[model samples]
Target chain A: MTVAAEALAGRSARRRVRETVVTHVCLVIGVLIFAFPIYLALIGSTHTSGTIGRGDVPLLPGPDAVANYAQAWGIGGGRFMGVPAGGMLLNSLLMASLIAVGKIAISLTSAYAIAFFRFPGRMVFFWLIFITLMLPVEVRIIPTFQVMVSLGMTNSMAGLVIPLIASATATLLFRQFFLTIPDEYVEAAKIDGAGPVRFFFDVLLPLSRTNIAALFVILFIYGWNQYLWPLLIVNDRSLETIVVGLTKMIGSGDAQNEWNVIMATAVLAMVPPVGVVLLMQRWFVRGLTETEK
Target chain B: MATLTLSGVRKSFGATAVLHGVDLAVRDGEMIVVVGASGCGKSTLLRIVAGLETATAGRVMIGDQDVTALEPADRDVAMVFQNYALYPHMSVFQNMAYGLKIRGLPKPEIIRRVDEAAALLDIGGLLDRKPRQLSGGQRQRVAMGRAIVREPKLFLFDEPLSNLDAKLRVQMRAEIRRLQKRLGVTSLFVTHDQVEAMTLGDRLVVMHAGHAAQIATPMEVWERPADTYVAGFIGSPAMNFLAATLEAGGAAARLADGLVLPFADGSRAGEAGRKLTLGIRPEHLRPQTGGLRVMVELVEPLGAESLLHGRLPDGAEMTVKLAGAVHADGVLEVMPIAEALHVFDGETGRRIEPLG
Candidate 1:
């Protein structure tokens, strides 16, 4: 019996080892597949444009790294796109920060009202807001642009962000979260002499910390990656976002594209969003999975 | 401390009435427990008193001030919720001091009050810990501490001990009672547990179907239940009710199987042949010769005593509590104590008191 049990355990252990090996192999392959393009962009940013123009994309870093990046940061696409990469980065950063903060503020308050209060037409208002989820930005872009034009909000940072701030998804998530909070807390707060405003600032806001962190990371990335809306609304070169400016920097026909500078700009544009996700990764995961309440 | 009075308090949610005019006058520094089964509107009564739910037509007076229209905060009442409802992010000190801070108390006074409450609850060591870090019993202490620090006119507890484990619940129930008495705050505690109601309350308000069935001291309520409902609801291994008719000139009740049981007390004021219900507690049945024969079906030994579940000859179920172990093959004869009998009117289910 002992011999048989040991043999069975050995076979099981071998199977476990094989499973681990297979899982790691699959994960490494997945990581490479996603990271290869960014690796190529990093490498391409190090070499001269003439080297890339000659169709000799190098696998290793070249000697022209500092010069290429400095030129990209100071001059940016040289004639194809005149706004400096530094200024464009700042614009993208400001727009993304505002959009993330604005979306969270509006969603938290709206969700709080809909979840906690009993007023006339409450469900009707909630459904109206929920129904907007079916309408994506692409679908409402034209009408929204017209509204922005009427308001004379075009070519401004507010114009880029204001239209994108009303987030149905965030509001829905927050409303679901708010509903899960036990009614006992509200009763306790009421008995504790906390009015609606005090409860919101003290209890609700503190309880929503992880959720806010999670939403900030998501909304920041969403704002940073915006292309079609910013491309259409902002005509001024100074207000160009990095994501839109990168594409415009590539010359279409019969012109030598500054491939190296564009690659450097692409690498720079990816930095802020990546940094935010890394910084908030712990809270982001906890927000989705755990409830402190 | 203050007296709480709820006069003609009624509540309805869009035509469905939850509380139907519950009138109660609680004395100062007394803990009154409202006990009932679920859906009996006991929680609604507590909420009404706490100003969480507005009574449809009533006036709530705390001491001399009418607080029916006042907000919960303005009424100077603090509540301990079933879930404890401690602010999760705040430390124990912050949780206790939140109300004091909201009232704009001086910082040093807030600290002193929080410290005093923490010491009282024996949670002084856990002052800086958040609620999530505490055990269930510790969290319960923090919740009570939060209420104690407020020094409100009234303390409202909404089944606060129901969330704890059985052992923890018993321990916390005693702690809450001790604390309430020590603070000398007028309190209204609501619980569905009869044991909790019996042990913790100075007086119990037994609720039934949106009405206060009986309000009396725990012993008084047990010794003389107002109705058949209160008799059955307030006792463990509930009192067994037998269908009978009044006879012997309202001095005795005749069972369905022709067994006559005389009332040991004075005769009731009901006519002969009037339908009546006789309530006898399980513990009152004693073995006797030539008594009502019960066909023994189940015996549940409870260490010191045994509970025998059987049926009378009329097929009516009866439970008997007897001291020590008893081995009955098929039949066991038992007679109920006459003085321990409770008589109720068959139609309205109200108690029929004996005449002078």
Candidate 2:
């Protein structure tokens, strides 16, 4: 081996080693940034009130976690405006389920129509529905509120569930996915003597389980973490959702501010979302490329 | 198997018409192929028979029943799509058994039918495998297997081999022909490949623009095409055409090589210089010691046979099939035989009757 060639190879090896270090450093830093806040939230949920207020990092979780969670339910919050934390959790669950299920049911039917059947004004109808998506929910809040009040649904979960049932975004996404399926599958089923109803159930729906699961998880998370709409609809404390309920626990009267109780409730609220994402993680990455055919 | 008939059937999408009024009778147990270029409406006619598309105006009768208005399922027909369109979610066994299952066939019957079709297609080993797990030829076989299990009154194939590789396509084409013959099922296959049409079809229906330009046995269509369009499309390295006007003794097919084909079409006697075009198969332009002279510009030898690309005196590029090999460098002689010549009217491009 020549000295010059050895030095050249060594230099290149050194450069590659340096590059590897930099890449690993960036990856570790990115992971930390993304994960640290969730770690803090979980840790904060476990601390004693004084430890939580110190607001310094807890190297490990404190021992008062069970006590904090119980306190968050208003065993110590003074009467708490008629009902307790358990009732509020129930209310949020009902509202989110109705919204998720309703959105998927309606979206599936509309997507099937837009993707498969040819009817007069199909394109026009889709364009009209899609135009609603352009109007941000913020701009329509006034109208949405007025409709809710007129229907006597104010202060009720119905106000939160029904008005937001039609999701044009989900419909459009599902429709695009459905359109990639070959028409020949439909025709093949037809020639086999299956009618439209049978074809939709037997052929289309079974093939779309992946897309449906991905959509279900996405819409479920959106419903579970909804804030502004639920806050606006539920004025009474008992009817409050997890997010609204968590907010009212501030300055919540203790030896020190009970940040632990508030954080515990927040942690519980995060469960459904994290579960949904984990369940559909495979499909989430796959959604973009599955229709290459 | 049932005899299929179409009478005065017309189909149009808005202002664009696909299948013009046409009549055809497909004999029971006969395999007929509809061949044409991309927009020739052969697929459309097949779809109408499958009940996938409705005919704008007329009746389609299958066996003794009129099935023009019934849906595809109601009509007793099966179609194999070009893309194969095998249900990705279903296994091969399920794909073949789907139609029978839908019809409420017993479990034993469904299994037996699926097994029979799979065995026939030689895909019995792939019965449990999903479509994605199989190769292109296997998927194609599975598609045929699906259609076969149904035992429909008619089977319609729409360019089913277009997606396969060239070698596989040829092999599958032969396999499908053999299967159709063995089944002796009434079938209509649509394809753009003249070779497949010639080999698979007991009778060939040649279409152009939306019209059935010629309908006859494959040999008949090849030997005697109805017009210039049919002549050009039905043969590979397509039939050559030359332009000139009709002459007194015979029509003068003036070539670009400054030579004229003195074809024996005497119907236009004393009508010299009448606009005309001469049609000749490449094999007919013999490289003999006679007729006209053409400069051999290029030579493409295909082992046993070769193609001689040359130009006539009038500058029209021409190709001639040479027997064995020819060592002509920019020079060759070709005798355009009279009996082998097909003379057509230059204006209408229709075959001119020999007046001798």
Candidate 3:
């Protein structure tokens, strides 16, 4: 028998079907719990723009979807107090890109150094980086904001990107992943006259594509979903991101609020990160499980 | 090929010194195997020669150039690790071609050289296969191919065949010897197995406790060991040792239980009445009708011979490699006649060279 057939032969047809049924049931329940709020918001937008009560659920998508999207993007906003969700969408994309690229660049080089080089104080530096992960981000918010202000980086993507670049957790993970690679490959490359940089880019990076992809997915989602720091720094309506835009949509208090528009904006804002998750679905699972130890 | 020379090579980690001032010369096209027990610094000496590791205080010369400060790549040498460190992601062809590619050889030249080396190692069929797909012996051949394709001046092997099974290890050992002879690169092979050293190396360096006990031909080392360690380590089932003293005017070895073995030569030189160790090979001892009375403890029968492990008088251990299947009876008088016993200084455990 073939290896795949032999592996599957141990389980009976009944057991396989039973497992599939249970997995599908759990997924259905989870989808229902998450999708209910968007349904109500969408229905609230359709019913003359004020019927957001939970008792009446919409059987179909609301007709006011396009109108709400335009209003959220500030096509008909009275002033700029309501964030331009279009500009926020663009900021989220640009900020997430900068944070992803910068974090990967820094983490890759740092991980390479810590994992391979025999520099003095390497262990001490690695321990220091590891210790930073224990301090909660919330506790440092006020000081971090002041530091950002002093650096004149208070209201830009750089402001969003730089504070996120000090991530010791990502650096530690990448270093550990680099460590799992056998020293033999690096040694062989060195014996072939490969320099340190050549070893990283040529040997190490090629072998770590899936890992990089996985970390990109995770960090992109993290930067996209970030709130408190951006809320404090980005008071300008034009600079607010998707999360802050969603918060404004939820907090605005007029009786005729279009819940459908808010729900559509929320779902649209989540598209890119969700797309990243689906694209790197395999690598996300593999990389996370691989770096567990 | 280049002549590799190591002078005053010493290595230590903190207070623990492993290699103590080893000096040796490896000629071009010669295969030298450093044989020793574990932690005896054989591998350390090989690494220092390859420039993979730095010596505490030494001069490493390749041909006429001093490479003490140069890295391994600058040394223009290649090594085969014990674990067969083939790059897992690359095919056999790529692994063989990697060094040449690093040196920026032309594409055709790299392919030609890799193919030639693979063919030489009888791994032509396995070129496109990754290392994981190949078996143990195949992986070993590919590893050798990786080293010799560059026509390096020196080849350093750190127990290359240690990971193979017994039968395959012997086969690969012979193959490696043949390959080294064909390539004519000066090679330094480190192994804890004396049998591998004897079969594969032209000259053997026997080490003990960070010291070179003897560096000579394998036969010379086996026949005339410099010390008790070499004598004991070079043979299988090991050399049997008994506590004794030289008496009767240095003409004989006197056992504590009154078993006197007279040397064929006149006397044991200046070692008269001094405490000594009686060394004997198992094959040298036999069960006679009546010579010395002893009891049989156990008899292990091989297809060709039977090994008897028992005690001599005064409760010291002894072994006898006799012919045929012999059952273990209670008592037997095993006689060891003239010229079969070896005598050594008991206090220092140093071999006492027999008188002419």
Candidate 4:
């Protein structure tokens, strides 16, 4: 009976091992499928432009990583319109950071007012702000550009940042989060001798830290990937964002493109947002799961 | 510590009136508990005292100041909420110190008061820990500590002990009473628990619907409830109410089952044949050889005491608390001790007092 039991145990263990092997094989295939394009981009960024132009998709990285990245960073690829990738990178950073901070600030205050206060037209005003979520920047680009020009903000960082910041996704997220904050906190703060403004800074802001961090990651990525707005507003090459600059590098069809440098710039463009996500990953996970009551 | 006075305090949300003219006068250094069922505006009344809500038309005076129109910050009051709204991000020390800090108290003063309050609450060692890290009782203590450090003119407690478990609630109730007395801070506590109200407050306000049904000492409210509502709400197992009519010029009330209960203090002011309600607490009923006949439906043994739930001849349900155990069949005879009987006008539910 003991031998029979051992044989039964051995058969079940083998079945379990086989199941584990199949699960691991599927996960590996899934990872490779998602990672293939990024892997190809990495290899292409290291090869010379002439080598990539000859239509050979190199499986392994060549030795031109240093030259390609340096050229993309200092001297961009276009002949007359060779906007330095360094300047474009700085512009992207400024726009992205400004938009992220600006949206969070506006959204926090608007969400606070909407969620905590009661006044006339509160819901109507909330609906007004919420309706903007459906009409993205692409749908209202012309009207927004006209308004920006009227405000003397065109071709400036304000135009690039402010128009995109008007979207209500962040505000809705913050309002949903703020609504979950117990009414007791507000009442407690009031009895603690905190006025509205003081309560905002002391209680509301501190309690919103995790949500703010999670939102910063999302907004930063959204701002960094802005293409249409920057391309439309920024007339000067120096003000070009890295995303728009990458498209400009191809130089209007059939102008022998520097694919290696563009690929290196793409890799560089991804670093800041990826770093932000990694840095805020702990807070992001907690913010998504935990609720303050 | 200061006196709190609310005169004709009324609150309305659109057309729905939540508090319909609540008037209370709490003496200096006194703890007054406002007790009621849910939606009875007890919390609303406390919030009005805390300046969290504006009364529709009334005046609130703390000490000598009329603070009806003042903001909560300017009212110089502190409140502890039911959930113990300790800031999740702030440590025990900082949570206690936040109000003083906001008022621009000097750093050393804030630290000293926070330390003092924390020490008083016996949470001195937990000063560095956040609220979420503490146990429920600890968090409740921190909330109390936060209120104590402020030294505000009035302390408003909105069911501060309701969230705790049974054993912890009893412990905290004693602590809160001791602390309030020791500090001598004028306080208004609101709760739906009669036992809490009885134990914690010097005077209890029993509210029903939107009105202050009765406000008196716990013993007075329990023994001489102002109305049938207060009579029913103030005791465990609740005061038993039976439909009856005045007889012999209010000297006696005759139940529908033909059993007549006489008043201890002679005749009352009610008219003859006037409809009335006879209120008798469960514990006031005693077994007698010849008394009202009842059919026992259920028996609950509570070790030292037992509760007998039964139906009278007229089908009115009554519960009697008996000492020790009694071997009995399904039927028994019981009587209401005459002095313990409470009579109310049936139409208005108002208590009918004996004549002077």
Candidate 5:
């Protein structure tokens, strides 16, 4: 009986190892499939425009990598789009930061009020805000653009950021988190002589650090990847975000396209969002899964 | 330390009234425990004192001032919650010092008070650690430490030790009692555990259905419970109640099975033939010959002593506690000590005292 049991265990152990090997092989294949396009873009950016223009997809780097990146950084790629990639990157950074910060600040307070206070029409107001989730930027773009134009915010950073700041998704997430906080903490704070404002800044804000970090990463990427809103609202070259500017760098005619410089600009555009995710990865996972409270 | 008073304190949520009317005056430095079963309005009374819940129509006076209309922070009260409610992000020192900081105390004073509280609670080594890192007992100490540093007019503890394990609960209970006495802070503690209430409170207010049924010392409440509810609630294995009727000119009670046990204390005021309830503590029932017979069905050995659960001949369930182990499968004759008998009016459930 003991020998038979040992033989069964040995077979199961071999099966487990085989299953693990198969799973890892599948995972590596999946990673390569997803990363291949980005890897190709990286290789394409290093080559000269003439080499890419001849339609030879080089898997290796070329010597003109420095010249291509410098051109993209200083003068941009397409002739019609005169704004430098450097200026556009700065514009994108400002817009994304403003949107992320503004959304978090507004959502935190609004969610706090909704969760903690007993005001009339509170749920009504929450539902009103929630209803807007169904009407995304694309659904109400024309009216939003008209409002921006009437407010004289067109062709400015405000137009690019302010319209996207009121995020219902973030407010809902924060409200759910705030509701999970035990009423004992609120009572304890009150007994400790902390008023509503003091409690918000001292207790509520510190406890929400992880949630804020998680939301900031997601919202920053949301703001950074905005293509349509910035394209329509900002006509000035100075306010052109890199996402919209990158598309403009690729001209209509095949010969007119500066493929190498455009690829370099695309790579530059990916840096901030990727860096944000990497920096905030720990807090992001923790916030979504567990609450410090 | 200050006196706490509640006059005609009533609370209602919409149509459901939780506390009909509760009046309690706690002396300075007195630890009064309000204890009852769940939903008995003991917690509601504590919250009213803390200003966490507004009394429907009453006045709450802390020391010389009426604080009924004031917010919880302005009430000069500190509460230790059941879950401890320690700020998870803050270290132990910060949690203890938070109230003082909010009150705008000078930095040095705040540090001194927190350090003093930390030492008193024996948590000096854990001041730098966050609440999550501490064990159940340490967290309990931190919660008490937070309450101590405030030096508030009143301390409100809302079932603070219910979250600990059994052995730790007993240890913390003793520590809390010692600390409260040393600090001499007027406190109102609420709990459902009878043992906790008995050991901790200088005076216990036994609440039943939103009413303070009896208010007295633990021994007084034990020996002379004001009503059947208090009599049954304060004792473990509960005081076994037997239906009886006043007889022999209110000097004795006749059980349903025709056993007439004469009162050794004194004669009651009730007229003859009046329905009455006779309460006998489990330990007070002695096994003897020529006594009330009980059929022993289950025996629970509790180490030094054992509890015998059986039924009387009249079909009323009774429990008897006897010293040492007794293996009895048949009927056991147990007699109630005449001096330990408690008589209550059957209809009203109120104790019937002897006539003067």
Candidate 6:
């Protein structure tokens, strides 16, 4: 081949390699930017509170990792109004699991009825439920607290979970999914002598498995991250959730915070939600993006 | 198997009337096909008999039991849907056994019945496979097996083979007919395709505008349609209609172009100048030495026979099915066999039978 043509080809190949190198460098920087804070938290959890208060961020692990975790799990973090991380984690787990299951159950039934059955004021009822989508817990906190107070459910586990269970997002999601189910399935089930209840359990419920699994991940995270509602309703230390209890570990401006125990609590709190997402990663991705309908 | 009867079944959704008052009797072990165009309420009528739909006005009886008020479950009828409607989660065996399980049948009995049905449909090996894992025809057989295992009093089929390819549809059609006949189940099959209606049904109910235009055996409906609508709907390439008037004391009809054609039977009662519609199937028209002349427009060959589409001398278009292949470019003389000619009153569209 000609020398000029060979030179041009060589230059283009060099340019392409340079472009690839630049792209990888940029992606590495992006990853570090996101991962740096979590790294700092992990390093902080392994240090003594004194090391954190020295006003320089600890870049490496310290020697107190085992002690900090043990204290966080066994004893309360702060001296006054403190709750153990272990009990609080259990409370959080129960509340989150209950909220997830409750939301899926209610949303599935309500969505099925709205999608399949003909009733008086069906659109009106659907709109009423859908309107709840516009109002999150922050907006209805005062009135909901008042109702919970009157029902005498405050300071109880039921107060922590039940009031947070009616979810319009999950309902709308399931309704969209249920709409994709063909009418022929219902008709075939009816002819096969399945009553409405039997059809719901046998055909409809089984068809909704992937959707349920997908929604569970979102609901679990949502339930785990809840702080304001639980703080308002449950002041009892025994009923404190991990998220709320984590905040209670910080002292006022003058007093030094138990940075090591608090960071350990944060790590522990990350475990369940992260584990759930990882465990159901396949279905979560599928449910969120690929609807068979 | 049981005899089925629908007396004056009527339905309406709000102000839109879907099914007018209708009456039909389905004999024991008979398969009656309800055929019509979309929106003709054929599916609605089948749903009513299946108890999936409630008729606004009528009594439905399966054998001696009045099933108008019963739920589909209590009505003891099984249906095969157009989409097959196999449960997405269950294996074929589980799907077939579910109804029996619901009825609290013994486990062994359920197994035996499901196995029997699977063997009958040639789907025994597919019993453990989910519905989505099977092909369309396999899913259809599974659906049929599910229905067959129920041993219900009546069977309802709502265009079940419509989803398959043409060849598969033809094969499944014959299979379904053979199975239904072997089982001797009273069945009502609904479809919009006239070929399916003709080949599958012992009797055909041709629906038109929410009304039963004709109810008769396939040959009877083809040979002597009760009205112009039925005549036009039941035949492929459709029946040719031409405007004419009764003359010669109803013994003959005078065409719009001033040609006269005799009716098969010696006719008697119509007024001489009454406007009439003459119906002739495509296969009944023949080339004659002296007949109505037509200007040929297009020809469609179907291997064994060729259809010559042309305009009659009166300017009305018609199609003639000629035996073997025939090429026509300009004009041809074609005449309808007198015995195959149909006459209807132009105003009411009702058949005008000869006074025998």
lDDT of 5 by residue, A71-100 (tens): 888988875446789999999999999999
Minimal lDDT window, size 10, model 2 chain B: B261-270
Extract clashing residue pairs from model 1.
none
Q: State the lDDT at A8 in candidate 3.
A: 77
Better of 5 and 6 by DockQ: 5
Model 3 over residues A214-255: C-alpha lDDT tens digits?
889988888888888788888666777888777666644554
Task: Compute the lDDT of residue B323 as modeled in candidate 5.
Answer: 92
Q: Lowest lDDT 10-mer window, candidate 1 chain A?
A: A75-84
What lDDT does candidate 6 reach at residue B348? 87
DockQ of all models, two decimals each: 0.86, 0.66, 0.41, 0.71, 0.89, 0.66
Docking class of 1: high
Stretches of candidate 6 off by over 4 Å are A1-30, A76-82, A291-293
- The Cα local distance difference test for each model comes to 0.93, 0.82, 0.81, 0.89, 0.93, 0.91
Better of 4 and 5 by lDDT: 5
Least accurate 10 contiguous residues by lDDT in model 5 chain A: A75-84
Off by over 4 Å in 2: A1-15, A54-59, A70-91, A154-157, A235-239, A252-256, B244-275
Question: Model 2: which docking level applies?
Answer: medium
Report how far off residue B82 is in candidate 2 (Å): 0.4
Chain A TM per prediction: 0.98, 0.85, 0.84, 0.93, 0.96, 0.92
Per-candidate TM-score against the hidden true structure: 0.98, 0.91, 0.89, 0.94, 0.98, 0.93
